[model samples]
Target: MLHGSDTKYRMFRAALLRGRTWLTPVCALACATVGASWFIADTMVERIAMVGSVLASASTAVFFAVQLAREVNRRNERLLALAGIVETTGDAVVAAKLDRTITAWNSGAENLFGYTAEEMLGQSVQRIVPAGDTTSLQANLDHMLEKDGMHTYEVKRQRKDGSLVDVEITLSPLRDLSGDVVGISSIIRDISERRQFEGEREQLLERERDARRDAEYARSLVEEQNRHLVELDPMKDDFVASVSHELRTPLTSINGYLDLMLEDDEDFPATQRQYLGVVRRNSERLLRLVGDLLFVAQVDAGRISLEMTAVDLTGLVADAVEGVRPVAEEKHLELVADVEPIEIPQADALRLGQVLDNVLSNAVKFTPAEGSVSVRAFLDGTHAVVEVEDTGMGIAPEDQARLFDRFFRTAAAGHMAIPGTGLGLAIAKAIVEGHDGTISLASEPGQGTTVRLELPAQSGSTESARYVETLL
Candidate 1:
C-alpha cells in the first residue's frame, strides 16, 4: 500500500523523467478513474464482486518505470557536473573525450603548458606529450583503463617557453553509462618553483661545505704561524717586566736620596731641592703606570686574587674625594660628595677604594675650570647605587662600549691631551664585577658621562665586617 505522499511523488517523478512524455498524464488519469470505479462498485453492487484492477496495476507500473528513468537522468547530470568541475579547475586539469581527443582544459593547464583551448581542443591526447614521453603517457592510459581508477606519477613536463618543469600527474579513467572506458581525466601540479628552491639550497649547502674546508685550511696555517710567533711575545713581556723593575729600582733609590738630602743639616738650596722633588713626583707617576701594567699581566696569568671583606663604602668615597682634592683645586673644579652613611656588602675595601679613586680622579682630570665633579650614593632595593657624575669633556657614544677594554683610550681623551694609562676603568670594571656587582656607563659627546656601580646591599652585623681572609 503506497502512501498518498508517495503516490504524488511518483507522479512528480514521472513529470521530470526522460523518454516518457505521454506517461505522466495517462498515469494520473488512470489512477483517478480506478478510484472512481472502486467507489462505484462498492456503492452499487452491494454484494461481493471480483475487482477489475488492471488500470491501477498499469498506473503503478508506469510510476515505477518513470521514477527509474528520472533517477538515471539525475545520476547522469551529477556525473557530468563532477567531470566539468574536475576539468575546469586551476590545479592543472585535463580530460579526453570518447573520440580519444583532448576535449577539456582549465586555466591552470593553459598557464602550465602554454597551450590554448582553440589549439588543444579536439586534438589527440598525444599532442600535448613531449616526443620522448608519448609512449609513457599511452602506457599509463592503458594501465588506468585496466584498473578503472587512476595512475599517478611525478615526471617532467615541457612548457610553452621550451623549458621543462617537474609536475605531479594523476590520471583517472572516464567511463560511459555502459561502464566502457571513453576518456581519461588528469590533474597536474607544477612544482617547478619548489624544486628550484630545493636545488638552490642544495647548492648553498655544497658551497658552505667548501667554505668550511677552506676556513679550516686557513686556520691551520694561522695556527702554525702563531706557533712560530709565540717565542717573540715572551721576550716583550720579559722586557716590559724587567725594564719596569729596573726603572722602579732606580726610582726608589732616587726617592731615598732626595729624602736624605732634604733632611741633611747642610741643606741643599731650596730651588734645587724643589727640582729634585718634581723629578721624584714624575718618576712615581711613571712607576704607577708600570705597576698597572704588571697588575694586568698578573690578572691575565690568573694570579691576581681578591681578598674580600666588608667595605665602608662611605669611607672609600670620602677618601677618594680627598685624594683628588689637590688635583681638583689645581684645575679650579669644585669636587663635591653626597655620600650616604650606609654600609655596602662584602668586597675588598682597598679594591673598592681604588675603583672610587680612579673614577674621581678622572672626573677631576677632565672637568674644565670652574666645572664640578660630584659623587653620590643611595640605596636601590637590595643594591647600593653609586654614581659618579662630572662636568667634563664627555665621551662619545661610539667610544662608550670599548671604555672597559684594556688599553682602549677614546679619541676625545686624545684630543683633550689627557694623560692616562687607559687601565684604570678596565681594572675598576674587573674589581666591581669580581664582587658580583655590575658596572655600566652612559654618556653623550658634549654632555658628561655617568659611571654607575650597582652593588648588593648588606643587612646587619652578620653581613658587615665579616672578613674572610682568602684569595681569588
Candidate 2:
C-alpha cells in the first residue's frame, strides 16, 4: 500500500530539472528581436513574428510530451505497487540476483524457507537450496537468460531447518527499460504437505494390497489344514460318517469288534486295552476338530441360533470361573473375577456363557504357573465392559493389531503350542458383536495382555434393580 505521497510513488529524478531545452536561448533571442523591430524595422517585423511563432510552437509540443511521459510513469508506479502487494501477500516470493545471490524474499518465502530476508539476502542462492539442486539451479538461470519469456517449473527446495519441500516455482527474468537482462523473480508455493498426504495414500494402498495377498495365502494354508483335519480324532459321529462314506463302512467294521470285545470283557488283555485307548483318543480329537469347523461355518454363514433370555451376568461369571478354577489351580495360577453388581438388558444366556467360557479358558491356557488371570466385568454408562487380563507371554505390537483375526496366533502363541482350535476368540467376537459390542486388546511384549469387550447395556431394562456379585 504505497501512498501517493510516498517517496516510492514520487516523480522520477529525470523529471526534476531537465535543463531548459537546447533551443531555449534561441527562442529568447527571437522574442527580443520582435520587440526591437516593432517601430524601427517594420519590414523585419514580419520576419521576426514568423520566427517567434515557429519556436513557440516547437516549445509547446516539447512541453506536452514531457507531461504525457510523467503521467505514464505515475501509472506504472501504481501498478508496480499493486503487483508487489499481490505477490508478497501469498506464501512465497523469491528474487535472485544476476550474480546468483538471493536478493529479495517475501512473507511466504519466510514461511517456506524458514529464513528472513536479512539471513537470505546477499547470500549465494546455494545457501538455502539443497546441494543437489545447486548445479541445476545455476543451469536453469543460464537457460533462462538465453530463453526469453517467463519460465515456470517445480523445484525441491531446502528449508532453514534442513527439511526438504516441494515448491511450485515460476521464474520471470527482470528487464530494464531497454529490455536488458537483469535478474529473476519467482513465485514459490509450498507443496510439502500435499506431497506427504499423497505418499501416505500410496502407502495405505500398498498395505491394502499386501493384506489381500496375505489373506489369499492364508486361505491356501487353511485348505491344507482341512486335509490334515480329515484324519484327526473327531467329535461328531454323524459328521465323520457323512464326510467319508468309505471310512464310515470301515468304522462300522471297527465298531463291530468293539462290541464283541466289550461283551466278552472278562478276558481283554492289557495291550488290547492300550490299543483301544489310543483309538478312542484319536477319535475324540477328530470329533472335536470337526465340531469346531462346523461351528465356525455356522458363525460365518450367520445360521447359528441364539436363544435370548434374562440371566444374571454375575452368576454367569461365577459359573465360568468355577469351571476353570481346577485347571488354573493345576497350573498353580490364580484366577480372580471382579464382576460388578449390575445387571444388563436381556441376553442370550447360553451364548454369552459360551463366550465367557472361551475367553477364560484361553486366559488360563496362556498363563504360566503362579501367573494370574483377572476377569473384571462392570456396567459403565450404557455399556458392559468385560476385560480378561492375564500375566502371560504377551502379544507383540505388530501381532496385536490382528489379534482378533481368525486363526491368527502370535509368534509367542505358536512357540508354546498352546492347545486351541483358534476359533474360540473369533466365535466369541461374532457372538459379542451380534449383540452390538466391540472387542479390543491392549498388550505389550513380556508385560501381559488385556482383551477387553464392551457390550451396550440393554436400553430400556431395569438393570440397576438386581444386585451383581463377582469373584469365584
Candidate 3:
C-alpha cells in the first residue's frame, strides 16, 4: 500500500527515466488512466453491477488522465521559463560535460565569442582558453570537482577572432535527479576594460614616485650649496680685517707728513701748498675708508666692547651738531639742533657719540649749499627718541631698502660723485641696535630724508646687548 506522496514520487521517477520530452508526459498520462480503470473494474464491478459500473469506471479513468496531464504541463512550463531566463541573460552561459566538451551554448555566448551555437556545441571548451592559460583552467576544473558545488575565477580566454580577453567565470556543477554530477554550467563575463583601467592606474603611481624622488634630490642639492656658502663667509670677513689693519699705519704717516708740510707755508711756495692740500685731502679719504673696513670687521667677528655709563642724551646731540657745523658752514647750509634734556640711565657715551657723528656727517655731505639739516631729541613713553631730518638729495625708493647694508650706496650719490665709503648708516644702525634700540628711515626721492632712532629708556641686559652686538 503506497502513500499518495510515494505514488507521485514513483511516477515522477519513471517519467524522468523516460526523458523529459512531449512523448514522456503523454505516456505517463496513459499509464495513469490504465491503472485507474483496472483498479475500478476489480473493486466496483460486483458492487454496482453491469452497465452502471462500467460507466463509473470509465469516467474515473478519464478524470485521472486529465489531472496527470495538467500536472505534467505545469512542470514543463516552469522548466521552459528557467531555460528562457538562462538564454536571455547578458553574460555568456555555457554547459559542458565532465569530459570538458561543450554541451550547450546560448545567444549570449554566440554574441560574446562570435561563435554560433551550431559551431560551438560538442566542441572542446579548451578552444576558447588561451594556450598559456590552459594549465590554470585545468586546475580550476579540478578544484570545482572536489568542491562539488560552485566556483568563480578569472582567466585569459581567446575569442573566435583570435584576440585575447580577460574574463571572470563562475562554474556550477549540474546534477541528475539522484544528485550525481553530470556536467558543469558556467557564467562568463568579459573584464578587459576593468583590467586596462587597473594597469593605467599602476603606471600613474610609478610616475608619481619618480617625481617625488627627483624633487627630494633637488632640495638636497640646494641645502648642500647653502651650507658651503655659510662656511666660506667667516673666512672672507677675516681676510678683509687683516688687509685693512696692514694699510692703516702707512696711510696715517702719509696724512701726518702732508699736514706738517702744509703748515710750513713760508718755507714752501704757494703753488706747492695747493698740491699738498689735494694730496692731504685724498689721504684723509683713504684713511676714512680703511677705518670703515676695520669697523665692519670688528662687528662681523663679534668683538665690539661697550663701556656703559650714565649720559645726557641732549649733550650728545649738541656736540655732534657742533662737530658738523664747520662742514655745514663750508657748504653754506644751515645746521639746527633741537635738544631735549633726557638722561639715559645706561649707555656707552663714546659709541653713542660715534652714532650721532655718522648720521650728522651724512646729512651735511648730501645737503646742497643753502639747504638746512635739523637734529631733534625728545622722550616718548618709555623710550628715548632722536630724529635727524636733512634737506639733501634723498635716496631713491629702490635703493632705500638696502641703505643699511654694508658698502651699499645710493644711485643719486654715486651720480653726484659725493665721496663716501657708504658705511655711515650701517655702522650707526649696529650701534643703536646693540643698546636694544631701533633705527628707521622715511624719505622721498625729490623731497628729503629723515632718520629716527628709538632706544629703550633702560638699557637691555648685558647678555642681550652682547648677543645683539654679535648679530650686527
What lDDT would each prediction earn against the true structure? 0.72, 0.69, 0.77
Q: Model 1, 307: alpha-carbon shift in Å? A: 8.3
Highest TM-score: give the candidate number: 3
Candidate 3: list runs displaced more than 4 Å.
1-134, 140-204, 219-234, 265-286, 318-337, 357-375, 388-426, 441-450, 458-472
Tell me how many clashing residue pairs each candidate has. Answer: 0, 11, 0
lDDT of 1 by residue, 1-472 (tens): 2344786455444443432332222323443444332211111111112222434444554444444555656766897898777666678888887556887877788888998877888887666666688567767777777777888877787776777779888998877645887888889898888889999999999999999999999999999889877876666666767777787788777777767776772576878878877887887787777777776766655567788777777777777878888887787776667766557657888888888889888877877888888888777888888898887878987888899999999997887788997999998888888788999988877678788999987443434332211111
Off by over 4 Å in 1: 1-123, 142-148, 158-167, 174-183, 188-247, 250-279, 300-302, 305-326, 335-357, 373-390, 394-405, 428-472
Give the lDDT of residue 308 in candidate 3. Answer: 83
Question: Can you tell me which runs of candidate 2 are displaced by over 4 Å?
Answer: 1-285, 458-472
Question: What is the TM-score ranking, best to worst?
Answer: 3, 1, 2
Candidate 1's displacement at residue 76, Å, is: 5.9
lDDT of 1: 0.72
TM-score (C-alpha) between model 1 and the true structure: 0.56
Residues 374-454 of candidate 2 have per-residue lDDT tens digits of 988887888888888999878888987777777777777778877665677777888888777888888878788888888
lDDT for model 2, please.
0.69
